[model samples]
Target chain A: MTTTDLAQSPAIPRDGDGPVFREPWEAAAFAMAVRLHERGLFTWKEWAATLSEEIAAAQDRGDPDHGDTYYRHWLAALERLVAAKGAVGPAEMTARRDAWDRAVRATPHGQPILLANDPRSCAHRP
Target chain B: MGAHHDHDHDHEERWSEVELRVKALESLLTEKGLVDPAALEVLIQTYETKVGPRNGAQVVARAWSDPAYKARLLEDATAAIAELGFTGRQGEDMVVVENTEAVHNLVVCTLCSCYPWPVLGLPPAWYKAAPYRARAVREPRAVLAEFGVAVPEEREVRVWDSTAELRYLVLPQRPPGTEGLDEGALAELVTRDSMIGVGEPLPPAGAAA
Candidate 1:
């Protein structure tokens, strides 16, 4: 389906009825997923299915569905989709995540968290 | 204040988790050449500065000042909103639900985060969270109470379920005793959460502030 259809479709997430990102990283997670899907990495249908699965799985696990875990689910689904599509392996994602944790810790407040040259910057590695 | 400060460590840990997860995902997509960091940056910048709650606040201000505009807004929100230039996909089929002295309006998207991005920018984390979605529809009063908003018992609380095609924007009541205020000054009283119905506009003379 077209982007217009997807936007109007009940499937793909629109992130809300509009700038409500409580935290800075929520916006990043949202922009990341949207940009990836917009680039044709995955169809909106695929995205919806994966995302719904994450939400359902959470519900199954007794998640209160208070919306706290929404982005966590979004992240999980995105990771699963990309990993399944051969974008990155589970190990690589884990390693990069750890690197980001380190980078975030080492970086001071008010500075852009650059990934390169940071001990945990794995994306730039050959 | 100390109690609030005590949550800092928990907040920090959660923030790092979200931040690092996003970074990891972005990295994966970037490495695979499936996403452009520049494009993502542009999107973030747009939401951060432009196309935010300020736009909605302006619309509310205009409606408050101009009776003709308020009538038009109540009649056709999408068209009236577009007159202010909040058009396009996100603005289409937009419905403006007015809050009155007897009734308050709240909005939620239970399915997903279907929000009016053209005007509102992005949905805050809480708005997109499952708690807000599930509770806003089921127990709006409790949810509003958590936001420190106590709607009177006589005031009816109307919860609007924003969907993919249709989105709802709350037109909070204009504060009283602001008759001398201009549209721009009135707009200053319009806050982001108030328009979402989780809070109310500050009264005239900044009584709450």
Candidate 2:
């Protein structure tokens, strides 16, 4: 098969005009979703549908819908979809989120943000 | 940058609310079996190594050398960029505005962080910070000043605010006395900040050295 065909068996995301990220994390999120889709974790259609739902829910909850913090919704949908797939428990996800919050709290500025070992141990880092 | 940075001393509190949340998700995903770290690294490396500011630099460098491509870039940036194989999410649509003797262009995403991904991989920290989001649209000249970009009195400064569907990348004017520099060297002079219009390209070799 042609390289382009293999690349597009799952169509690659096309960036709109301008730069793709306002922040580094947006690229990280964007990359994560693409990687997950490439692994057949979820189809792009599934991702789009779930993301639209998440955006709608946010708007319902008074998200100005200006596209500010849109990736927040993207992350939420990702979390929900991964949870739904049973790859990881939702409660476990929340606990990890807390761990990250704590990690950030403890990390001095300019140092790398690393999760504490306890949860990493519990979660089975490998 | 100096005054504001000094004012905000509790640097540990710097991770924005969204950054913290996203990091947590990444951590959880890696810690769990939901996502593969190696696959994630492939994606990250794709952007870091294969696609990013270098690609943007190549585009700018080509435009500097080829006027026809530059015209196409401005007229249909998306199509032109795709011709160079720089196409994907965050770069699905693009507008390449030129910085000329009479005009200077600056890019911002006041609403959210919308940028051209195929060219500039990820926006730097300051580009995504609250201060830039709040200040860019209100006072374009002052923001440029903070970045050390001086648009002379005769030239007008225009700020392009990006959204989900559209993004803008500034094509900085080629530096003077570089008629001898080849395209590769020209691309080397194209910095990420210059493409974003926050700063200018480096001086020519003799002048630079």
Candidate 3:
């Protein structure tokens, strides 16, 4: 493929000749959904249904729904499907979320937030 | 808050809360053995490197150069596109709409962002926005104008609404000066927006070489 022509336009996100993530988290969210579907966790149809439901829910919650949070809805749908398939429970997800929030706060800016950065994990490290 | 501290890290660059949430969820899933980071890496890499609008550009370019291929594309887009090796999920059903002097075609998905992914890659942000979805069909001339396309008063604009089962790709009218250009050079002129009918292909300038 020709890289020069594709790189000239800023409308689409291109990292080199391929599509680039506008943010790292968008890539993460996208991959998680596709991977889960690949593992037969849920059909693409089910995933689409869950995603539309999430988008509708967000619209009800006063989201502008102008597509800025498209991946946010995607992440929400993946979480919902993963939970529904008995892969993970709501409680575990919440606990992990809190742990991550803690880890995120503990890590210095520009550094990767490692799970070990969670102070609770550090506390348990005898 | 204005006190200068001797820290090496810049305070302004921090992960968004959503980013933290994704990392946390990934960590949780990985710990449970539900997902492997390596597998996720491969998936992301595939989309990043292997799939994108360049695929669509090639299809448009071939159609522009070969009348037989254009006939095949217009007749059976799915099979024609697959002949060029661009086929996968979300692109099983395909429709190629052509733009002529008297007719222009535009595409949108009113319900959600249903796009021809195997060819076009991911739909752009605006394509998924509520306003575009709602307005592209209702007032396509106005929408096209916003994208810097001013269709003449006599030409008719048709809108194709893509769905989960079917997707549309616009065959933009080739510019006048591109007759001498080869297929590869022609592909260079086919932008992502042109195939979506929001804009026209790049005019042959330095591309004729």
**Candidate 3 lDDT by residue in tens digits, B1-209:** 12324565454445577776687779888888878999998888888777888999999999999999999999999999999999887788999999999899999988778889889888777877767777787678767876889999999999998866789999999988888999999999999889999889998886463
TM-scores for every predicted model: 0.67, 0.62, 0.81
| CA shift of B34, model 1, Å | 3.4
Deviation in Å, model 2, residue B192 alpha carbon: 1.0
Each model's total of backbone clashes: 25, 25, 0
Question: For residues B1-209, could you state the per-residue lDDT of candidate 1 as single tens digits?
Answer: 23434443432322366677778878777877877888888887887777788888889999999999999998999999999988754577889999988899998877677777786777776776666777688678767877889999999999998765688899998887889999888888888888889878777775655
Top DockQ model: 3
Model 3, A57: alpha-carbon shift in Å? Answer: 2.8
Candidate lDDT (C-alpha), each: 0.76, 0.74, 0.81
lDDT of 1 at A112: 70
The alpha-carbon lDDT assigned to residue B127 of candidate 1 equals 77
Q: Candidate 3: which docking quality band?
A: acceptable
User: In what order do the candidates fall by TM-score, top score first?
Assistant: 3, 1, 2
**Distance from true position, residue A88, model 2, in Å?**
7.7
Score candidate 3 by TM-score against the native.
0.81
